[model samples]
Target: MKLPTDIQILEKIYKAHKNDFEQYENDNSIRDNKIFVRVDLLKIAQELKVDKDIVFGRLYYHLNHKFNYQNAGNSHVKLFINRGDYGKDEKGHEINFPYMTSILAGMQYERRKYQMATIIAIISLAVSTISVTISVFL
Candidate 1:
């Protein structure tokens, strides 16, 4: 099995939750023409299985051109796993850079992901595994 790269994982997650990113841009875009999506760095860090700083650095480094803002990427997109983290970090640092204001601004602007089917499938898989384990052991 081949492991997915950090960028690949990010792109996959971004595509899944693209609507949320678009919504963020729609609600928070400073200009009508320019679109700067507000991404959850903490989430990306969790999905990448690495430090959030690494993901942030990678995105910033790649998208350095015309990207003079904060806490946003204008070039590449990535996955976010920290469902709990939206606008603030553990230390309560201001997550929003310029337009993404408020503590829950990130989550507030974005729409919820439709993962009910996946969750149900996972539950079914777990139940089958548990049944097999019980039959084998007992």
Candidate 2:
């Protein structure tokens, strides 16, 4: 079977790895990564017309949990916003282009497991595997 193209792979990776990327943003060691989260929340606020404060409050809590930050206070949020890694590489290279690169990687990994499930379902004449994919992804 043919493998997915880079774009397709990235799309899948984006879905699966979005959480990790979010954690990356709140991690001071990776502060440059914060832009992705910042813009993402900004877009949500713009589109939903939600108050920025509320949106930030919610995002802050989520970020704190995901990043394992012991302190879930304004200071931590501020630090993450101001000094967290912005998804940069060791060479100070920002991986901003592949916003969904991590998700795509995860999708590729899941694809094999999914394929196996498909084969199993086909052999067993069970439709659950296809349904599972559709339900989870769609």
The number of the candidate with the highest lDDT is 1
lDDT of 1 by residue, 15-134 (tens): 444565456555655322223344566675676676766665554454232233434556442221222333455322121122322212344334233366667889999999999999
Off by over 4 Å in 2: 1-37, 45-59, 68-104, 111-119, 126-138
Measured on C-alpha atoms, candidate 2 has an lDDT of 0.44
Cα lDDT tens digits for candidate 2, 4-123: 343342343244446656786457575544434333434344444555344444434443244322355543322123124334312321223242344345657888889999898787
The TM-score of predicted model 2 comes to: 0.27
Q: In candidate 1, which residue pairs get closer than 3 Å at backbone N, Cα or C atoms, i.e. clash?
A: 10-78, 10-79, 43-80, 43-81
How high is the CA lDDT of each candidate model?
0.46, 0.44
Model 1 stretches with alpha carbons more than 4 Å out: 1-6, 9-13, 24-34, 63-138
**lDDT, residue 109, model 1:** 36
